[model samples]
Target: MVKKGRPDKRSKTRSQAAGGGGGALPSGELIGPFDRTLLYLAVFLTGAAIMMIEVLGTRILGPFYGVGLFVWSSLISVTLIALALGYYLGGIAADRAKRFQLSHGIALAALATALIPVFKTPVLLQTNALGVRAGAFTSALLLFSVPLTLLAMVGPRVIKLCTSRLESVGRSAGSVYAFSTVGSVLGTLVLGFFLLPMMGTRTILYGVSVGLLVLAAVLALYERARRNTLGLLVLPFVSLAIAGLLFFLGGDRLPSTPGFTTVYEAQSIYGRVRVVDESERQIRWLLSDSSTIGAIDLRTGEPEFPYLYILEALPRFHPRGRSALLIGLGAGQLPKLLGRYGIETDSIEIDPEVARAAKDYFGFNHPGRLILGDARYEVRRLRKKYDFIIHDCFSRGVVPAHLLSVEMLQDLRSLLNDGGILALNFYGYAEGPQALPAAAVAKTIEAVFPFHRVFVSSLQTELTDHVFFASTEPVEFKADKVDIAPSPLGKLMLDNLFRYEHKISSDQGFVITDDFNPLDSMQVRKAEIYRHQVLSDISADLLAR
Candidate 1:
């Protein structure tokens, strides 16, 4: 029988364990309040760092592989695999070891994260030869797998450390994961909204590595203080030194090009925007990721891309057009060109960085309104109508399929005047599996506008940029009627526009709608080919910048 004021032996043991007193487990020890707080903080920081690294993966791999479906797929798949393996291995280690230190996993993770910016160039260069799909996956795995895996282990070990009683195991695990998930949410928001735009990829990566190392050091100091051992505390300091050494050694300077100089470079939510100037050739290029979105002759200050010439000529079909709407303002060339014809142009640009680069470097000085937002949403908000609407948003070898759906075309059509012409620029092959996206675009455009004409930028039938002009009435390009006094190259392009005309059959592709748009999947081959061509033309070191 138990005394009225005293508890039984078993009940006393259970109470002590639940209360985190001595004899909580076989180790006969438990973390104090301060130590437990540090552990939870570590878990939260690791969670945030994991998400940050994952988001940065796209920006890191985008230069070589492009930000397409394959890159996203590879990144997501690799992250899941790393997390799974980490969870399994961490659970096994937690169950086997009598005592586990969270600092060990964190320190290793910090080192791994630090290695990314250091080894990214070599890893991407080697994997780039594997082609887009395999290269993106392999690059992501080689660079991010270890760090993500190590960071993932923090959750299990933290749950183990926080759970002092079997009865509290479920609650402890829930609490640990909840903190991690909240950290992830905050990390994603901060990275997308602020860090990527302000710091760029390499800087953000270095910061994340240092932050994780600091967390590890704090945990190490706490653990060492509790155990009365000073040796393990040196590990975090040593790791930090190595990380700092690597960061300084692995600088983020752009590699030198033989004849070109980098005039400007920045990171946007869309991708990396760079301006490269070739003095000898008198040409400057505006690049988004690996693809050259716009180019201008430094000597003449006129657009050099053949597609832009075709776009400029197509607007002449609607002779009475006094106002124009330009979507995807690359270097603001189209708007500037339209302004030359006394046409007031309103440009819708998605990335403010691109707009700034265009004005500062490319000498874009259009006196019209520059609306900065997604074309799909911004088009719906516009109350005014336009005589011509131009769509040229292709960049980084991937099309924004959402913007090309039948629904989006209808919106553009709604904004057009009766004789208004809608010109779209697309990049793909003319006749092959890669041609499906272009064919789908043509069909979707035709579904909205009855008459249209397609023109290719290059004479070759291979992968190239194609311009489609659609209107309610017959589309006509009277080159003889318009006398804009184009350059020799532009004149040549204008003269041969009909020679480059292509008519894609409806059967080749179905109408792409918002509910069922397969344009991304269909353009995979084309994107790979286009990216490869761009990569071949430019040095890998230049793109790595």
Candidate 2:
């Protein structure tokens, strides 16, 4: 059971008389000085690490399964449980020792922290079910339980060590809490806003591992080098090697034919963006989830070309691409394609680094009106109505909370012209050759649009992402409506997409929510859980093949 606060002697005595406080802690003087410092550092580091583990965890899990709610919840819940266990166990460990030794405990705890970078991928890769159920989530909780639980002990255990008298106990606790919280504030600002996006995930993991290992070594300074010393040296190198291998070996690095010139490959703020040479048909901008949002074709590269699906689909449905808006600008592919087609696309993309990568590697330059901000805010501010709009922005690792909310969709609706078409893409779960999530999304779209039809993108299997296109008027795929010479590049892409044989399931459903439009909130039967399992099986199957 989770318990809190140090009770006064009088209260303890009264409770004992009432047969409820027989094991009450005896009042002691404030804890020692060295002990307090150790306690403070431990808690401070613990808080920072917790934030790192929680935030970075999402990024680590994202590539396999888009950062959906189920993944986020799994990460959150596991971290919480780790903290809870750490708190309870730390107190017991401290009380058993009578007087706390900062060095040994701190060293032990830091060593545990350092181990994270080492075992992270292996633990994940080796996890049974590859995570078909809550097993993955549960195991993750257990893996980190050792260090986090120990870290949790700092507050209460330190109070026990530092409190010299009953009167000063409360004051001492507050001081520690304040300092620790301050550490948390700095941790969030640095890691979330600055360090993570810039440094990238694997590098950051290595840095954290080094800091922790160093902390442990510093604690053991006075004594002769322990056997663990060699371990400290070797482990960091091992971590470096593993991270390096994973980085280089990552993604679909293999060739994707001749004309599709893939320009840049970097893990950036918006997952991974690849600018492709569609043999000058357009620069196809691809995001991590393999979604293309923007393209630029033609030698002039001015945002004004009249072309195929986008051209015909928009105007034919009582809407058109005069003031076209796109949420994701991968390699400026869609923008390039649209600009060549004369659409005058307005793009709102979150990651500037991705834009830079696009420029450097994928021919991503400013396409028409560029809005470098969150799409939701940009859409809210825009006064002109859009004939065509694409909701390509997703939760950084999953569907962003703001984007999924009814308010945001309503915002998008307001910006569209009468009978305008809006396309939304999401990665969700489906079963039995039927795209359930597509059906659910269709239901949500129907609620917003007056008339709509759901189109399922061909995934290799039942459990794959589905795209939905909804409009104020009905939509049908018309080949003749498309203008321009069908570029070899677009044709190649179309060919690959053609292999995907997914049809939208009419019977599948979802609870339409105005408040919490959470995808992947289901823990046990989570999207990620099923996906990882499938991925592992695929990996094994491919290896055997």
Candidate 3:
């Protein structure tokens, strides 16, 4: 029987632990109220770190695997799976005798996160070599699964530590989740709005690592002081030192093939921006998300991309243009031509850095208004109608779905004067299974404008740039005069342009509307085909050396 005055050993220990207010934990060492507060703070940060990493992981994976629908779906799935596994395992671990030791897991997570930048390039390269869907899945699984799991474990463990009795369990879990969710919201806002746009990926990753390690240090110091065990406090410092070593040893290298020199690179809000100089060809390439935007001949300062030259036939179709609007600015090649012809040109470029890179490196000082923002919104706000409008916008060969919808086509048509011309540069095959994208685009355009014509840059090429021309009145091609005194190469390009032009049937496919647009889904197979071709080309280039 138990006595009222003196209890048994288990009962006495329980009383000492529960009634030991602001003293040692049940594990036989001190972790006071202050320490508990710090632990909660650690929980808050852990939540934030997980979300920040999830958001940034897409940017990290985009250069190689693309930010396509499949790739994004894989990333989101991987993150959710990791978090679920963490929750289950953390709950089991929390039931153990030792209970949750905040510093131990957090310190390890800090080190793991720091190592991401170190292994990221090689890991992604290896996975992306596997091809599109598999590569996107494997890359997300390999790079993020481990760190996200460990980071997620902190939440359940924090809930376990903060609660002392069955009565307080509800309150404890609720408070921890509330704090964590709020932290996640703040982290998303801060990272998306401020950090990502201004910072490099490696810089952001390392910063997060340092932040986690510092929090671990605080917990380590408090644990050591309370337990009077100084030996274990060195763990946080060691993790930090190792992180520093990884960063110094393995810095982010530019994603490029051999013989290509990286002239300029940056992490922009939209995607990765890279300017690569092809030494052999004496040309420079503007790459966004690892796809060539436009290339310029370094010697002549002329656009070297065949597609842009095909578009040079724009003014010939509609000669009444004293004013023109260009929807996309890639190295400002088209607008420069328009400006040179003394047409009051207004160009729209979404990315500010792309425009800046154009001016600084590509010599794109076209005499026109360079309006900065999304073309969809900017077009709606325009007060004046244009005689010529060029739609050459593409993100890695996929036109943004919003811009291609029937409503958008109608809106663009409304912005044009009577007999005005609209020229669009689209990349896809004009026949076979790959013809669907071009066919859909044609159908949508034909619905808006009564007269339209499609011209393929090359009939022999499987995937070539198809320039679509539409006019209020019937459109006809009239070659620039012989006495115009244009460059010999420019004259050759214009002469050959008519030869490469081909017709596309508008009755072949359904129209793309805003509500039922499936362009991204339709382009998946084409994207995969392109992805494989790129890998094959890279391999061939490497083998030829």
For candidate 2, report its TM-score.
Answer: 0.68
Model 1 lDDT tens row, 1-545: 88898869997766544543221133436556875787778778888988899989999988778888898999999999999998987776666653455677788899999888878888988887898889899999999999999899888777877877778789889988988898899899999998887877888888899999999888888777766667767778899999999888876675557777888888899888888887677888888887788889888888887888887775568777888888998988887767766789889999888999999998888787899999999999999999989898888388898999999999999999899999999888888776777888888888999999998888764877889999999997665666667656667877777788888987877898989988788777788888877776566777765
lDDT of 3 at 251: 70
RMSD of each: 3.8, 9.2, 3.8
Model 1 is weakest, by summed lDDT over 10 consecutive residues, at 19-28
Q: Is candidate 2 or candidate 3 better by lDDT?
A: 3
Candidate 2, residue 348: how far the Cα is off, in Å: 2.0
lDDT of 2 by residue, 1-545 (tens): 33567567776654333321111123432224664675577567656765675676655554444455555677778777866776676667655653333344544555565555456555655554444335447545645666666556655655554555556668867876776677667776778778866765656655664555454445334211322333334433443455445445442342244455555555565554444455535544344532233445445443221122332234333323566887866555565555544677778778776667656654656456767887767777889888788776643234554575556667788888876778676655555423444466666666677665433343454444454567776765554655644345444434454354345545665634656554544322434445544343233221111
- What global local distance difference test value does model 2 have? 0.54
Off by over 4 Å in 2: 1-42, 64-66, 98-100, 132-135, 209-320, 394-397, 401-406, 426-437, 458-483, 488-513, 516-518, 522-545
Highest TM-score against the true fold, candidate? 1
Q: Which model, 1 or 2, shows the larger lDDT?
A: 1
What's the lDDT for residue 485 in model 1? 71
Question: Which candidate ranks first by lDDT, i.e. highest?
Answer: 1
Each candidate structure's TM-score, on Cα atoms with residue i matched to residue i, is: 0.92, 0.68, 0.90
Residue 144 of model 3, lDDT score:
88
* CA displacement after TM-score superposition, residue 268 of candidate 1 (Å): 1.6
